[model samples]
Target: MVQVSESLFYKDVLLVFFEKEGYVYSNSSPTLLENIAKNLNNLSAPASAPKNFIVVHKKIIATSAFAVGGLVLTPIIVVGLIQAIGFGVGGIAAGSFAAWLMSLNGGATAAGSLVAILQSIGAAGLTAGATIGTGAAGATFMGTAGAKLFEEKSDSIMADLTERMDSNPKGQAQLDEFVKVYEEGNEDKNSEKGSTRVVFEIRDKLLTNNEAFKNFLETFVLAYNASKKLVNKKQQFKFFVDKTDKMDIAGKKLENLNVHLVKNYGAECVDKQAQSCTIMLNCSNL
Candidate 1:
């Protein structure tokens, strides 16, 4: 009877975390997603809050990972809202854009596998003493109250696309061509990380083509525009400087995966790599 009562009781908790612009997500659990969505409006940056606010119950789990040698040590804690506007959704879209990446030898997404994809882009994190689950499927989940998302939430979209690429002969042919080229170029220091390097190399090569670059730019701009709908108008955002450096503005934008700079990207950041530049990332709102 006491255990039943405890199960029904919800413990309230709050977490104030630093909001990194172009990257706002902290976890990939349904509970976190629903929590983030439901409290999107209330996640305003407090006067002293570095980035954003997190109001979660005991149901949510939190974790931090430490990479040592080739192994990752993760400790999880039941804890944590995340959904933020600006580059939050935009950032996620970029990864979704990279989902195909023609698989790394026998992997998918930029992170190798579906699970790795989540970790690579910071979409998912470790669970304290939880199994290292590494598979994905589409489905929806409910929040503690009445929160729900429109789709499988995430990770599913990328996985689904990867699976489909396998059965399509056209995709297979393209994949073969890319694999051949990547392998040739990969003769030097190629490994899993090399796969990531290749992905970027492919983007750079594709962008060099005038027509391809135009289409690419349009696609992302449209995607970003669509993502803006996810952010509530009343919610406010600001950027704080974390690390500073002099580089081309384009480099800064690329470094942070910023989607808000398309309007002036060509006018200001692109092709200015040789010139002096400033490096900045979306920091916790002041």
Candidate 2:
């Protein structure tokens, strides 16, 4: 579990919205997310980089580990950068972003197109070429947009909370209580306690009585769901890798063979039952 800053939390909500609208693939592999986050965070865009792009880039990776519920980094880095850059220039929705991506491949989003390649990277994992290419593209897009996009007031949950805190003493108190409980749940070392559970508790205990709180709860659930999906994906990948390590194959040491097996067969094995996965790998000619 990781704690997100106020700004980063807002960004995560925006990313969750983008993901739900099918604008970007936010549920990418943890390894891929971490690497892309690291590279983009360290990237020093040229002087020509647009102010808005720099702002989005800085806001996305403000955290040291670049992890906000494990779902924010990848989408913001890979595809959101393009959309955010567009936002700076004008406003673009999911459809517009898809059209722009299609234009990159001469108006085709079929296989081998940039759009398809990005989807493939999201489904599988990043290759060395994808890493360099995405980073370069992010940098290139950064210079094409200005910073006025985010200057307008946001309608995010955090903005709602802030407005409530400024205008309503009772609601502010309730929000403070919600924050305290949420932080305590996040800091709790118990395996059973997580942000999703914390959010449910907050909804049940604090928000059930208030209409404003209920509205907030609905928005907050999106972030919780995104976090849950990321956690599940990471666990599944780890499980697949662990199981791959235990297989006994002739003429090949498990340590040397495990990486290749997982890299080649991970997508196939990830969703299957352990016994079935073992059978498939064991029967493979590789």
Candidate 3:
């Protein structure tokens, strides 16, 4: 009775784990923020309460990988074991049955030949089932990991886009224009990160109404990349455009590609009166 109770307890514990793991995958699917939330929740679970948050964080990372890996591998191992056991047992049973029949029919050699064929088929099936099942599991894990990683990369790009737009109204306007033109979602792709995207319609409007607005476009791209580089380096910075597309003020074809820099982009930081050019001399100038 005690042994049975202990077994039941472990089984219930596994079921709970399976439930939690399943929820993690379901809630986190197709979303990075949900994945983070699930991680945090898991970290704060009763099992994790005994450990420091940092340790919990590390465990969360490992658990994410292992949990997904187990999901991939468990079925495969089970199937392999089933196939091996079924075939091994069935082959022996068939061989014995064949010999018994042969003894009654006085055809022992013929029955032995039949037994050999059955054994060979059973061995082949077992080998094939195990190999295929293992391969499928590995592939499943690779696919899931690949999808999650791609989502992370895309989130990073969206984040940079949001930071760019928020830092510059004109840039944000241009982005809005692009979104409308491209028929893409205007909401910040990084929904969890409080990021926003520029609309394409707004960008087109600027192009049509403000022909010289091309400088804003060029400066926007340059500043965005610069800011991204800084962010990658783990630097805290803000971005602002000092100068805009004002050459000939109404010139076509962007004659002077110039940009000005604000020391550190913030509401409190005053814009410098002097302008520093980021890109003033296009090769067209010689």
- In candidate 1 the C-alpha lDDT for residue 101 amounts to 21
Q: Give the TM-score of candidate 3.
A: 0.20
Error of 2 at 92 (Å): 11
Model 1: how far is 182 from its true place, Å? 11
lDDT of 2 by residue, 15-51 (tens): 3333333333444444433433222222212223335
Off by over 4 Å in 3: 1-133, 173-286
Name the candidate that leads on lDDT: 2
Worst 10 residues of 1 by lDDT: 7-16
lDDT (Cα atoms) of all candidates against the true structure: 0.25, 0.34, 0.31
Stretch of 10 with least lDDT, candidate 3: 277-286
Q: How big is the positional error of residue 125 in model 3, measured in Å on the Cα after superposition? A: 29
Write down the TM-score of every candidate.
0.23, 0.23, 0.20
Number of the top candidate by TM-score? 1
lDDT of 3 at 208: 45
lDDT by residue for model 3 over 17-49, one digit each (tens)?
Answer: 222333111222234333332322332233323
